[model samples]
Target: MALSHSLIQLLISLRRQKFIGAGEPIRMLEFGEQNWFYDVVPAELLILIDEFQDVPAERRQALKAELQQILDTKPPTEPFDICKVFYKLVFNYEDYTAVDLHGTPQALSLDLNEPLGLPPHSWDVVTNIGTTEHVFNQYQAFKSLHELTKPGGVIMHSLPNQGCFDHGFFNYHPTFFYDLAEANRYEIVALVYADCSKHPHQLKQLGSQADYVRLAVSHQLSAYSGIFCVYRTPTDAQAFKVPRQGYYDNRLPPELQQAWQNLAR
Candidate 1:
């Protein structure tokens, strides 16, 4: 069952406590200040940034110039924890080892296509914000995330909704809500929408008053509208399920059972 916003917040609070006591500081990669990082501290922290050619040509060039300037200047405080950041030019299977950046050793920059080989139940929290939609195989990604997290671990994710403009890259997909739940075998804890028009480009696209209204209404009705779901990993028995079988049996109160029979028929 999907979780209410209040229940989701409560779980986040509880997770924060356990995460604090885990003896290591919170470790976040590929996520930034927009996340819940301020709430927890880890003994060691690492961040990874992956670059891709899918970005707009102009923006890509501008970012490259910006990065070169930043690299030359060596700013006083690193934008993220730990020293190095990675730029993977191509997807390769054997590049999963740590890399040396700014004199620090951190895990090799991860490509969504590659596996980390992390044991099941290793992470306390995993967050993927606006990243999964870019992946070609979202189901495999979710399965990998499920395996990477410790039991009772949580995944915080945000997906784009309808009415979002195509940015020339494969930025959108349909039916992720149902797919993610089944893929990770997780119960959704919360679902919320994020107004992407808050970004200038999106807002500009809705130039006229009528256009803005249409966009707004479409966003409101979309099932994909930026969702935030928190799930507790099920126990082995609960997690295990056979293919082509109903997880819930038909035996129940007469009224409930009758409803189930009607649906089955």
Candidate 2:
């Protein structure tokens, strides 16, 4: 799994809109040491560089030089570490850590299939971008993501939603997140369905499961569609709460059920 340009754009947009990482620096924890699909740095990242308004002018210039060095030194065939190179550089935030079983330069050796055994509520931001689906123990992986996030912090995920056939252990559906958030009392920050077939991705923001179904019917969406989500962990978030399937549990709100019914008409 790799970090794509659209993910970076999502992060930049969140900062600009003050969704998170605004007043002060943030401590970010990533599931894996992820690389970019792009051979070279995308030009649009200059906008992300500009948003580092909290940093001093000198430090900001230094960050730019560091980015330039990466471009000059790194071969295009070997993509740069998105977490270390892009996220850290753009935010100028040093409190970033990545955990991977392989222990790459940007990651600490840790297994996601078991308990993380790390300090709880230590990270202001926890990300599982295209990582957890590959973990056979989905429960443990998700629990780790939940446990790592600090109170009032956010946990971001990008998982297969519609049709990533044989891409990973499983493909997710919108109800999975909807019910997960409901069970954990996580505040749903944003939910988006993305068509990742090409660059400059197409996205549809979703508020409910019906929205996902509607988006599927409304367009010639690709089989590689993805669910992009950000959910805020409340200060009082308890232990990781497993949820029953929303459909069988009759958990969907009445309005949403009506919406789904309307779609069938």
Candidate 3:
């Protein structure tokens, strides 16, 4: 998975809202060794970075230099490591780990089908960016995120919601997250749908978990979209909560089901 401009904005917004790095360094575990997809940083991102108030002046200057180097070198897109460079420079993380099936020879080979078996509840932020859809065993793919995150920490997922044919083993629906968060008792931080057919920043927020079905029927949204779900794990540690589909168990209202049925006709 690659880091797009929108993902950068989301991370920065989380920090601004004091969800992360309120007064401490971040410990982030990403599902993949993400890279910045663009050679030059987008202006929107630079503006946000300049406005960020948490970083000390010297650290900010260092960040400026790091970004300048990216522009100066115009590094090749492959193996640029821009995502790692930016996150490390900007957050100055306490720890950062990337688990992937492929990486440097020294990097551990990971299969998403099994638990990471890392120290339980060790990470402050865990991300599944564009990874789980490729895994056939979806349960294990998501359970690993639950196991790795510290209680009260955050878990973020960005996956294809609509119109990515044959790109992976499966695509996601917003209701999947609604049920997952409902079952796990995760605090809903943000739920957004992005029009990813073009630039990555075109996002539309889903007001609440209920809005997943509500908006789908009301707006008739059928685009090449990506679902971005950010949840704060419950403060009390617990086992992974298995979820049932919302409509099947009356978790979603009958009106929403009727509306969806009408839309299908």
lDDT of 3 at 57: 71
- What tens digits encode model 1's per-residue C-alpha lDDT throughout 1-265? 1122322333334344542222333333322112122222211111111233343466445444554555566464333321222111111111222211221234344555455565556555565555555566654566666666666655656545555456222443222443445544765654444343442112122222233234444544332234444465654423432222222432234543343455322
After superposing candidate 1 on the true structure, give the runs of residues whose Cα lies further than 4 Å from its correct spot: 1-77, 81-107, 168-175, 182-185, 198-225, 237-265
Per-model CA lDDT versus the true structure: 0.39, 0.76, 0.76
Q: Write the per-residue lDDT of candidate 3 for residues 166-261, one digit (tens) a residue.
A: 989988887788899989999888988887776645777888655666666677466787899889999999999889988788766767777657
RMSD per prediction, one decimal? 14.4, 3.0, 2.7
Question: How does residue 74 of candidate 2 score in lDDT?
Answer: 69
Residues 26-143, candidate 2, lDDT per residue (tens digit)? 8888887677767336554545566667657776676667666666676543354334556765443558788877546657888899997899999888888888887999899998
| Model 2 ranges with Cα > 4 A deviation | 43-47, 51-54, 75-78, 81-83, 89-92, 217-221, 254-265
Ranking by lDDT: 3, 2, 1
Q: Kindly provide the TM-score of model 3 when superposed on the true structure, using C-alpha atoms.
A: 0.87
TM-score to native of every candidate shown: 0.45, 0.87, 0.87
Question: What is the Å distance of residue 144 in model 1 from its true position?
Answer: 0.9
**Which pairs clash in model 2?**
none
Q: Which of the two, 1 or 2, has more TM-score?
A: 2
